[model samples]
Target: MWKVVVESKNQEQIRHLVFVDGINGRIRLHFDMVETSLRRKVYDNYNNPALGLPGYGPVRVEGGAATGVRDVDLAYEYMGDFYYFFKNNFNRDSYDGRGAELVATVRYCESYDDCPYDNDFWSSTKRQIVLGDGTVTDDCVGHELGHAVTDYTAGLCYFMQSGAINESYSDIWGEFIDLTNGKGNDSSSYRWYLFEDDKYGASRNMANPNIFEQPQRMTDYYYYCGIGDNGGVHINSGVGNKAAYLITDGGYFNGYSVRGLGLTKAAQIYYETLTHLLVSGSDYLDLYHALYQACMNLIGRFGITQNDCENVRYATLATEMNRTSTYCVYPKAPICDVGEPVDIFYDDVEGKEYWKLTPVTMLVLPKYLYSSEYARSGKYSLYGENLDVLSDFAISMKKGVSLPVGSALYFHFEHAYDFESEGSTMYDGGIVEYSIDGGRTWYDAGPMIINNGYDGVIYTGAGNPLSGRYAYTGTSFGFTSSRLNISSLAGRNVKFRFRIGNDEAYADDGWYIDNVRIYMCQVKIVDLTGYWVSVKQTCGRTSRCTIKGKFVVQNTGTSNSSAFKIRFYLSNDTIFSSDDLFLKEYSIKSLKSNTSKAISFNVKLTSGLNAAMRHVIAVVDADNVVNETNENNNLLPSVPFL
Candidate 1:
């Protein structure tokens, strides 16, 4: 007779048997190790798909004891840890923000030893975690689970900047969970490497992106323009990963110094950014805006302070993601090249070939040919002097040229003119006019004034007049007109005319226009340079060192730098963070043309000394306070100090 013993509700169990055909007796092969408190279920795929595989209440609750299934047990333990991490820290139940049952399938594929695949992933479609044999670790599991979290919120697209941001979020959460789950080195209070052991070493280093040749700043951004790696999603993810590191650890990245807000707050801020702020196709710059907003939200709700918000901006700047800089110069692109020089005064010695002028009365002014003469790169200039009374005088291009469509016509010339103050002259000025028609009805193209000083009389209201040169003064003064955009006459047959007249009240050395030529507008750009930090012992003894450092910044481009920042810190890590022991911030109110400033700062560390190691780091324009031509040289780290 078979024994009939009913089990108690508290001791729920599963029973399975191993048998040999009649020759051998049946033996109990598996039993359940059930924990009612856990809402998670882990299943062994047994080197096969778990779909439609036999008995089911909970796949993990199937015929299995804790002793026999190593992979299943490991998966179950890690899943439970993830659940607690979210529940305890974020005040959430599961990846979906609800008490959803967590499901995982381990030992996936046909055979554990024979299967070629070696990976784990979270399938939002399957709504479950899938793992290959020997591919289980806290980082791995956490990374996959983080994908599930991202799926529930943000729904970030899997390509371009959005995709990179998604990958970075997963890495961040994986590291976060790994560190929180008693799996990282606590002495350092941070672990930058993710999947350190599983991938045969650290798979990615968050502290520095250079380990994998990933760009840390937008200046070095990778543009896998071709189709591959999902637009270099995983490769470019290092940029955002470095951003997370800067936020949590606090340091200088790019040119900005991020304040260390600690992991807990950092996680909260990121959680809010992912859940409430980020959109599907958000790029790096978009992410920067979201993070900046998140920091402000923290300040309004959690009293985080304005400095924290500034840190967020700085961090975003270091990533070269912030597109806002008051000092940045954006030169317009040119659509045409330099055509044949159009000389109106026969100044080129070959000018008569292209010009045929009809004027009422005009005189040729030959500037003193000495090197000291401020002529417009020529020996001759057009001078209009009306000693009698206000008279109509004009100079026009004899031929017309057809401007291509979508192209811009720029007029480049140098001029100097003097004017006399007249009480009755309503507007004392010279005009530059252009005609699409062959000299028919003319349109006043406005002043021919240069800094020889005539512009004030033309611009100053109704009756105010000037008695000085229109632009600069003296025989040495000369003025050059910027590339004047003439896109209006594009696709039209056009010619330019210069007209200057004098009033009856008084006469002065008239308008002298020279070296007039039309060409393309060259793009103007700022080349930010300097911010090199040189260290010297300012005062104090060793161990309690007071080191003074000077940061030098210069404007090497045609454009000027209106503002900039110089950030300095003393720390152990290569990247600057808010959590570093010592740091200082300084700004250049204004840096002008071809000039440099040496900003000095002192670092004093007396207490909580490492006594063994430290690094003095100085970052120029850390916030990318201004657009620059070269960002690679901004960081200067002195030798490690004791």
Candidate 2:
């Protein structure tokens, strides 16, 4: 016998139907029309009173089996869990902090495709959550919502170390909410696993990430550096996940001991770091500092103690998050000496220094401008070749230089090029361009050339990308030096690049550039120092004191100074401030570099002034009428009057 059952429910009516087939012991079921409705409670942005009113109704359904209702129910339940967790703990209204509406679409499938979608993600552009079937577990819901919080706050870029941190944050919050939500499994055995209840088994182990092929420490061999998974965004997140786990539960791993601060304090510290301290480009080392700083900032509030901060440091060390050698370190500004002609930037092209090669056309395989033996001064020079017709290549400095103040700056390089040329018209050539606004817009720098200027303008036709622009075309016969007066870019940060283009008809040896340098002229400063040789005080008739002193001035700069005045003050401290009492103003003649002059001063102090309570301070170039490279060293240390 075969049995069939049908059940339906509504506010006004409830019905049940059962059929058993007696003939041939077979049963078949069919339905002409079936309808389902859902009435859900909707809450305001604030979610103030914790209870919502019934509002939304009638979910459309057509034809397909209703196998995804359970997933939808789980999504709603866990989303509510995420909302209450952040709201009660962090006082956050919503993901955006201003009560942005939380939108989620479950059982999502791409357009024009019928395959079962198996991934979940937060659409930053659409500002919503999308989940495939069977993926709406508690941690999964929390994980995607955490991304929204990150978007509105730190907005961490999703690449490299920053991207890894971004992924780890989602995992951290997801697991935290799952453990504390009071609805999911909170047992110790199940506490550290993400997606533990999902049908696909566990996705990651926060406490032991190595089991799932994730690097728990930075120095691990599994630490990914390849150009996959968005620079190993998912795989490298294991380091951060392990750090979070150690901070919360405490452990002796990787030779460092951490005392557990439990989930509350750990969450607070990580939340503060993510929302307040970290920027979009923050990496692992930056994260360590941010975590420690957040811990310190939370002291005296939220019951955070100094011991918790110590654990934070130990956890970061245990995870090797403070190491920079294992990953691509963020570029820092080159330090420059005061008056030296420092090469602010130089690329021999023997290996990658600062310039990055980019191909504008896909006409050739392995289209990279490489470092080759076509050297001018070094063993290797940046070389670009037109391997295929209609190809364009460029090599640009990835980092910018902050030109020194009060110095003449110049751009120097040696290059050789050979392009397809006919008479005075060049069909293929190279050009130089620069950008001051962080590579957003580039301007032709040919006008600033001071030596070995452009050879000719590229022909306006023949499918050359650099057509109609003055460039370095034709053969240089040998490597030649080029200089550009870039003093106008002083005090501003700038980046530069060289680009070469070829026509569809012909190609030749492209370009070779070496020994690139951005430098400045030797800076000169009129640095001055002063000292008091003698001070004699004598009392006058009306309780006034006559003070006499011998003062000396010395110029230590490389440049001679014009006539300048010196001012003496009576200060209680070594440093001079405006509140100090002015004693005398003395004039000095022009002093050559490295020369000294001594003068005697006689001045009667007023009756109210006490010479015994002050020290004598001398300041040269007091009005700042003369420019100096080191203006801070113009003040004398100070001498006692007695």
Candidate 3:
């Protein structure tokens, strides 16, 4: 064919040049070699069609109808095929990515300052590579060129575990494609692309890393000076590289060396994981899950996990981290959500908020309302005095707009405040009674319920006046009777009233109060028909619950609870009880931030004592639990649920 020329150097040095024609410009793909530096071999599919993979693209000629060293500003002409590919694909100046008249001439550059990498390296602008002659190859082309692909196709692969992840990923594809297309060199190992030299050669140990760490030192980010090819992405990817290597070889990190198939298998697995499954920079967990799922997809779960695959890919991820997983655990879902008619109706009352309002009893949403960690997001009010009246009173719900199901509701007595108090001490027979029956009936919340003697000051007594922000006095108080035990009366609408004084000299200082808090808790109970399970739940203690059959451990009474754990054990084991079916040994759980169980576990008691009786005994702490303490802070060891 004749020669097509764009900008030619009329140096009488060389003749017979390969010319590539363009729309407005003509260029020559010079094959400068008297010795002909081209390899002639029968390549299957991976060989470059025009010239072999670039070992060296150009050389200086002295003189000839074919050779003479002329100051030809351009580098060795690229492959006519490659030149055609470029001219056909990227021939545009301002054009995005259509036709390929990309640049007038292809030359070589050594430093980045002279090149415009920053300008269009990642931008959707130009697609050209002026590689140093030493940096040419179909594999290398696809690898480095692949960066432009991702930079063009997807956004910059930013989350590089290392600057090389992109390189690594694309390397896999490039290597495979070259091999697949007969363009790959025999020495090109995906893990070792040793032909090019390992960058993080240390981390590339594949057998061991704690060495060859100069370029691969992922602990820092500067080893790659300005080689912003992968955007310095391959830097932090040793871990992942090793992961890939190990993956190909069955990921058997026995001691150091890897063992298994090779790059082909590894490439297949990783490509599947990355392209279809993984979101780039996915965590190890996600990786493992993806790998597992992908493998299952390719060759059925049973096939992979069973004898079908010899290696039995068990995912070294979790093992590498030394982690243990419990049974199938789902992410905690939103417990509650905002629903229609966000009010609890009493005894089917029609639209009436409060059926019976109490007097001596004050109604104020606890001013000291605690924003529980779980309830801070929304307006989650456990119990608001004015809740029945004010819509502002809210409950924190996992479902943000919804409410938690079977969630215990509770309020904090956080210090105290006067809600409508007068403070007279004659005892106008003021009583604080509670009713579970939709406010229809009222029962004494506790014995501390004062009558014809005490004054109107709850949590307000002797040596202590309410502290700094406290409303009044009595830092503490005890109930002579069950103060407000609604455990036995769960699912019951409740109300409290006062009869302090009708205008008499008895009940003066109206009252000090805090709104009640509601908590919803679900207990997992195992039925001990004739046998038992172990309860390991303790103040961080391991306990077990053994049972004969399946029995439901429902939230017995009220869902709300306060102070430490309030539970009972029903094991077929021996009882620590001294009285009628009571566990002498207390089974308690420690609580973290909330008053809820710190660590709720279970214990196995025995039916040997009363097997036929099915005695489920109560266990309480020495301190104030569901048990009522007298006004003197005296322990009232009564059952939690009155």
Candidate 4:
């Protein structure tokens, strides 16, 4: 028998439908509601009169069949769609992925007059999402549920930059689902707009945020330093929202262009990024790395082409969060499980023993670029200013270190130079040189190559009389030096210098250098394995059962594991490294060489297990705590049952 049930609230009521078994006395399908006003007043005192409406309370309504009520039906339909989106599309079990109940409260108190007297939020404490009557739109419902997905996955923090990413990810989910479901087909209206039916107009527009007074690029970012709105989380989220739009539909912004690969491919990249690459404290640049990692994963997992990867790259590059980037020995370092970097030396002109300044007769102003107070590193930086025609000046650094096999030297430094702009071979620009004999002789390493033109201040020596009517317009902005191969110079005293001069007239802004560092590779090796054992039952009527098992990982390298994280995943299908279902992560603390540890987890089967079909993979050093000789061997799967 089917019946409709109505429940009471403050001066109103909601209705829902369910089926009741005539013989079994069981009820199926329930729509529950809670009056948040009552919960909030009991938990956080009741105050009315001053700013707005009446008190709120909790109520539950159920029915045996369709009630045809608008809000209740809308909530139930939206929730079902959202659940199906995750389960059918991504194989996610539920919000928590373990069958957590979907609890939502409708008719939340509409008292506060600011924006959403009608509002909604996903309460981590309540373990349920809530919606207000005024804010009950399809996209808003999806947006709030997205918070639940993010909570179970990356669990990004709720404040500051991380909070902004959290918000943007939710918005991305809403738009992706709508477009995928064919609800956002209106080209001009709903493509980038969100929450159209709300009391206020669309809260955010992803394609172009300028209409909403939001900053879509890092340069136009709004950083709220005050103690309100959790550091402008909703405001700063436009950066990531715009990135999503560009990734899905391709557009040009801020001097950067991206190719749109459509929403299907874009959603795959974002899902992987949110689930695998992000952590609680990740910021904007971290999102770029996460998206890059996702793009690389798409190449192997989804048969994505190089053009698809480039689209994702340019999409992230438009966000302007690439504010600080370093050219590593391997440009694709972020996409793979890269080796660990071992710092050799770092000097920012704070010390003087390693580097020496050689000035010529006409004078070489080799000192800190700016005053120590204004220097980039809060300390003096290496500065070289030689305006003398035919003058020669250089700053050299000599240091000796043991370089391991297969390790490349990563020389990272920032610089700014403005030299003679006219000639094909302008002699006024600086050249990096390597020397073996202290300072007696040197070989030209290469011209300092600046890939992206400098954006910082370009100083031309206009005040000097020698610089009259001639301002060298050539400027190379701050960038890292090429990966200078120190393999041949390994195990010996290595020296490098920067030299700049001119044939006749010298017009230059001089080179300002700071935050210099050299890095080598460190190696870590880990062996991983997993196994399960089952016991037989005694009687003939017995059904076989399998026991939950554990995976073991060991440090097989010469050095310790150094507190790296190891992951164990279970999959019935083909196990692709990190693309499989994540089971658990364990932190191994300094496992000395030849040491092993085991992690046990829960698993059960109704019948005898075909261990040969099922796979358990252990990923050691999951976060790349230490570089290893073989990145491919980090993942080890259990052998088939014999």
Top candidate, metric lDDT: 2
How much is the lDDT of residue 626 in candidate 1?
Answer: 68
lDDT of 2 by residue, 1-642 (tens): 455545454222233344446786544554423222221222121111221122122131222233346765676677777777787788676788666766666666654263356677888876767776577789998999999998787777676677888999999999999999887667889888999887677889999999889999988877887546856889989999999999999999999989988999999999999888876546787888889999999998778999899999999999998885354332222223345565777776667677777665443422556644345432467777754477676788888888887676778787766678877879888888889998877888999877777878889878787888889987654345677888899888999888778877777667778778898866656877767788777786677887788878888877888888899888888888899888789777788999899978787887677677467778888888777767887777455666
Q: Choose 1 or 4, whichever is better by lDDT.
A: 1
Off by over 4 Å in 1: 1-38, 48-68, 110-116, 184-190, 221-225, 300-303, 323-642
> What lDDT is reached at residue 93 by model 3?
15
- Mind giving the per-residue lDDT tens digits that candidate 1 earns over 563-603? 77777777676676777654688877877767777777776
TM-score, candidate 3, is 0.33
Global lDDT scores for all candidate models: 0.61, 0.75, 0.31, 0.60
- Give the winner by TM-score: 2
lDDT agreement of model 4 with the native: 0.60
Relative to the true structure, candidate 2 reaches a TM of 0.51
Of 2 and 3, which scores higher on lDDT? Answer: 2
The alpha-carbon lDDT assigned to residue 180 of candidate 3 equals 43
- Candidate 3 achieves a global lDDT of 0.31
lDDT of 2 at 453: 77
Clashes of each: 23, 0, 118, 11
Model 4 stretches with alpha carbons more than 4 Å out: 1-64, 110-116, 182-187, 221-227, 324-642
Higher-ranked by lDDT: 1 or 2: 2
